[model samples]
Target: MSRLLSSLRDGKGFDIVLVAVPLAFLLVFSGLPLIYNVVMSFQAVDMFSLGTFNRPWVGFKNYVDVFSLPATWPIMRNTVIFVVCSIAGQFVIGFALALFFARGFPGSSYIRGLFLASWVMPGLVVGAMWNWILAGDFGVLNYALRSLGIISENIFWASNPAWSLWAVIVANIWLGISFNMILLSVGLAAIPRDLYEAAALDGANGLQKFWTITLPMMRSTIGAVISLGLIFTLQQFDLFASITSGGPANSSNVAQYWAWEMSFRQYDFAKGATISVVMIAVVMIASVIYVRSTRHEVRG
Candidate 1:
């Protein structure tokens, strides 16, 4: 017993213990809940049977019901669009900003730090702020566009079915840009300056150097950023709740918010669980891609 205690107190056993604590915590908190959700997806669950573990096993009936719903495909399509567009917008804009700051202009670091403010702010708070910005009557966006003669009339960004989805996407992109920029900036910073110097000696211009050197070096980081972005986008619920609430005839509804609406608002727990299971599968695929990307990372 004394030997065991000593090993735990002063040896590699201590490191194992440190890892075990968090692992145990995850098993109890995260793993169990995830297992329960998966199990629930396969079971017929009502509010009455929710408290008990023993429920009717419905197999894939819930999944079938989920797919049979008329709104399912549209919501799934919207989710895909939201995820793809938000990621593209965030990554493209973020890469641009990262490169811009990588130039090391005076006060660039401070300005880049300020951009993190958007990312750290609560999503609901960001959504609320954007509410007025995208508002129809006196929103700054419309006002600016009208001032520049971009639109003939005030656009109801959040209310109109055609624009409502895009409205959320726009806000989501803005919210995600900071995170993407910060990660990409780190990736940019990790790249050896010597490579650029070598490329310059070889008469390589900015574009050629970026394509040949910067991109290849940052492959791992890009994969990580994109995978994390996909997960974050899938888990995004606060913005939907605050900004759109899946409004305008559910034009802006995505899988996550729709899952919540099904489980809580309408009490269709099984279908909600089904939707979440599908989302989990999508995230798992992204995780696999991230792992594959990391395998290609160049060693120093």
Candidate 2:
């Protein structure tokens, strides 16, 4: 027992123990549940069979049925739109903010810190706030747009089929902007100022310096941010639940919320598992991209 204690205190056993603890934790919590979810996707699962592992294996029937549903294609399309638009908006605005703050004006740090309020807020809270902002009547958004002469009438953001999805997307972009900005600010800070100084010596204009220097230096960060944004946007559920609830003929229903609806609300566990499995596949791809990007950044 003394020898074992000595080894743990000063030998490779300590390293092994440190790694093993977290590895075991992950195996029990994350790995097991993920494997179970994948397994459940293949087998026939319902409220009755949910308690046990032994069940009828339906093979690809769940997948086939999920695809066969009329709402499946539309939901998939909305998911794509949500992810693409949210990521684009978040990255563009975040990068702009990061650049703006990198200039280091008076009170810039405090103002930059203030942007994190949206990020730190719970998703449901953010969704609730957006619900008020996007309300058909007396909404701040409509008030602003009307004041700008963009529209004379109030837009029914949450109820209208055309605008419901966009309402959620806008809220998501707002919530994610600070995250992107903070990450990009780190990347921008890492870049050697000497490169910019040298570029200026060569008479490179501001646009040229940004296009050539800033973008190239931030490539890995950009990749990592976009990949993570894909995962986050795909996993977004609270906004849909609080804002639109996938209402008005499932106009804003994405895969994540649809999976919950199938599982809990409709009690179609097999279909829900199938939808989750599909999302898992997409997230895994994004994880791979994020890993590669960070690895490249470290290597550089």
Candidate 3:
């Protein structure tokens, strides 16, 4: 016992045990559930046999049925639009903020830290806040637009099919901005000051320096950011649940929300699992990109 304790305290055993614990935890909790979800996707699951794993296997049937649904394509399109617009908005705005703060102006760090308040807030809370702001009448957003003379009347953002997805996208972008900004700030900080100094000596202008120096150094970080954004965007369900609930003829519906609606609301566990499996595959792809990006990081 003493020898084992000694090894654990000051030897390779400590490192092995340190790594093993989280691996074991992940396998039991995360890995097991993920594997079960994939398995359930291929099975003909009913409430009667849900408690056991002996349900009849009906491979691809759930996938077929999900695709055959009339709302599938429209929901998928909304999902695509949501992901694209949210990531674009978050990245552009976040990058701009990061660069601005990187200038080291007065209280930049303090101000940047404050921005994380929005990101740290629970998604449900953010959704609820946005919901109030997006109310058709007397909402802050509509009031602002009206005050600015941008529109003639109030727009029902969460109810109108034309604007429902966009409403969620706008909220999602705000929620994600801080995360993108912080990560990009770290990336920008990691870049050596000497590079910029050298570029300045070479008579490079601001745009040329950014395009030639900052972008190259930030390649890996940008990849990691974009991959994580994809994974998080795909996993976004809480905002939809709290704000729209995939309502108004499913205009704002996405895969994750639809999966929950299927499993809980519709009691179609197989189809829900099928959707989850598809999502898992997508997340895995993003994970691969993140891993590769980190592997190729240009350390300063």
> Which numbered prediction scores highest in TM-score against the true structure?
2
Candidates' TM-scores? 0.94, 0.95, 0.94
Candidate 2, residues 188-288, lDDT tens digits: the string is 99999999999999999999999999999999999999999999999899999999999779999999999999999988788899999999999999999
Model 3: which ten-residue window has the lowest total lDDT? 291-300
Q: Candidate 2: how many backbone clashes?
A: 0
Poorest 10 consecutive residues by lDDT, candidate 1: 291-300
CA lDDT, candidate 1, residue 7: 88
Which ranking of candidates, highest TM-score first?
2, 3, 1
Q: Which candidate is the best by lDDT?
A: 2
For model 3, residues 186-226, the per-residue Cα lDDT tens digits are: 99999999999999999999999899999999999999999
lDDT of 1: 0.92
Clashing residue pairs in candidate 1 (N, C-alpha, C atoms within 3 angstroms) = none
Model 2, position 74: C-alpha lDDT score: 98
